[model samples]
Target chain A: MAGRATPWLIGLTLVLMAAGLVGGLWLAPPDYQMGDGFRIIYIHVPSALLSMVVFAVMAVASAVGLIWRIRMAHAVTAAAAPIGAAFTFIALVTGALWGKPMWGTYWVWDARLTSELILLFLYFGYLALVHAFPDRRTGDQAGAILAIVGAVDLPIIHFSVQWWTTLHQGATLKLSGTPMPVSMLWPLLVMMLAFLCYFAWLLMVRLRAEILRREYRARWVEKI
Target chain B: MDSWHEFWTMGGYARFVWPAYGVAFVVLLGSGWAAHRGLRRALARVASRVRGGRR
Candidate 1:
């Protein structure tokens, strides 16, 4: 169903990403304090946000699959797992790079960092459970349960900075307002949107391939 | 030329800044390529199965 639209989505994602990079790396002014090092925020923040957003998406898809007994929903959970993991990985590495210059250490055993690491592990665990079972249905069920359980970490990751005295700074962008100047904020916002588009594009492509694999024996698939 | 050098230097934090972006670029691109390859492989397998069944 989404085959024709996939190419268009990829094109749109690329354009937005290019605009975001230009806005972030070139147009945005250097921070008064951190100077150009703050530019990493353009990549780091969007990646960190997507890390959690993708997990929430996977958890919701897994829940729906469990409730509705929909194979396609399970396929979506499968498709989203590795992408979420990749974002989580990027967030960690970029955060570390930012940390070393700002925090003077590569890592700290802080609440936010630890919780984000756990989120990566959660993704790995889900992927493992999905493949562990002999029957695909059983694998889906097992993976779904693990995904639902792991969602408890999302709030923990979000609130960690607030609840603990971590080296990591408090939220840069909040519901009320961000302290960032308009020049910097706009690029960050654009980059966030670009990353989101990239995520959606990947999810759609992976979901199509997953659905095809799962339904290869069905009449509709044969028609394709 | 001076301004270009400053841009690349990233105010002396270039070591940390460039690698962060580089890794993000590589990981995202690698995953996208892998996904596309997976789709092609699935299509090939399905086509073959259908053809074999006909025979």
Candidate 2:
């Protein structure tokens, strides 16, 4: 791995993330109803979206590792557990905050909220399984299998609100709708992009660390 | 309440709104710090092992 490439990738992510945060937090318009507090949506929506994206990435990486015996893939899947868990935490927190104002309660047992809670549990379960085995390789393989099995629950998480009775609001920033005012939309989009960049940047750093740990005997690990 | 409008503005809801934000801020900072620390520890362990392997 070229030393230059990693730095460049990280640098690009930082630049994109900064631009996105500024656009979302400062430039975007407050919601007509929620006012200034609606700004949390920038953080909230991205976290929700990334929670799904990160898990999907982990599952796919684990599959690759199992099928092709690519240790790099296993490392990637293992590295993502905590990051995805963090995103899920953000989503749940922001949701509760927003709900306090809008729904008149700090927490609710609605279908959407419950399902999101389950997603967080799933992430924790995968992490726990990884550490359960006495052998590290056994842990990795077991965790990978768990990731694949857990992926089946993702679709349920996504559609739970639509199918069941829930207090959570439906999606607002769809591609087809007349977009929210430019003020609001700009900031939301910027925040979403910022979060995506941040996720990628963090994932790469974690994966690199995992690579080093697993291949510590190799010359590359020594140089790093 | 000063006025109904002010109350809806969370002049009264300040307790709820501020705590939500506070909780979120704490969670974000804590997680980021944890991840950074974990990675650093992993790197250090790897570096140590590499040195031992060389010996």
Candidate 3:
């Protein structure tokens, strides 16, 4: 890739990822009721959180791409598509898995799950729209419009469970409360940090490749 | 690893938990592979373009 990610950033991301994994796997206390099955929370919650974060990021980048006519911004939004889709898919699958054991069913059209599912569809639709266009700039512009429009669903997804009687559990970890016991909270936090690092690493790698792809004619790309 | 065994056992809730982890595992692995492939392909394309221009 023409764009080089700093070694320091990559190293720091790995360190955070390692800490998160260790904290999540060993340090966190099992749930009083669900026991280790609750361990899945480490991955599930982070994945869900990141999925939303990625969408918001793509939306913002799309806006930047549209407003400033920046090819790099368009590249970022494009690179984000599949990664966001993957994270959303993980969240949905893991949620369903967790739900089955706890809720005694494989699937439920609960508000939170349903809204999250819609988010996934939005990602897919955006991808489809981007690819459907013959002109690259037109594709980026159209996709950007869709991304901005689809962002309306994000708030609904975040607050869906609270706003509706859903099978999904309410947020256990919040800024205000003491949080689940230190043991559980530590791992959960670690996992969240790790997931964020992982996303950074992925995004950088993806963005670097994208920059090279879209800016092949650029001078710096010739050397790197 | 015995961890796999422990995972599937799930303390008698084997079916529900295993599938969840299994799917997550598959998705992560698949995405990792896809990302690697994408990076490599993009690098190759850029490399060739750079080389072709020089020639």
Q: Which candidate should be chosen as best, given TM-score against the real structure?
A: 1
List model 1 lDDT by residue over A96-203, tens digit each: 999999989989999999999999999999999999988999999999999999999999999999999999999989999889999899888888988988898899
What's the distance in Å from true for residue A218, model 2?
3.6
For residues A1-224, could you state the per-residue lDDT of candidate 3 as single tens digits? 32345355557656876776666555565577986677678779988998999999999999999888988888889988888999999999888878877888868998999899999999999999999988988999999999988998899988887899998888867778965888778767776776676677677777777777777777787776
Mind giving the per-residue lDDT tens digits that candidate 3 earns over B3-48?
Answer: 6465446556566555665786688668766766777887898888
- Chain A vs. true chain A, TM-score per model, equals 0.97, 0.90, 0.92
| Residue B29 alpha-carbon offset, candidate 3, angstroms | 3.3
What candidate 1 keeps of the native contacts, as a fraction, is 0.74
Tell me the TM-score of model 3. Answer: 0.89
Best by lDDT: 1
Q: Is candidate 2 or candidate 3 better by DockQ?
A: 3
lDDT, model 1: 0.91
Which structure is stronger by DockQ: 1 or 3?
1
Docking class of 1: medium
**Candidate 3, pairs of clashing residues:** none
Q: After superposition, how far is residue A95 of candidate 1 from its true place, in Å?
A: 0.5
Docking class of 2: acceptable
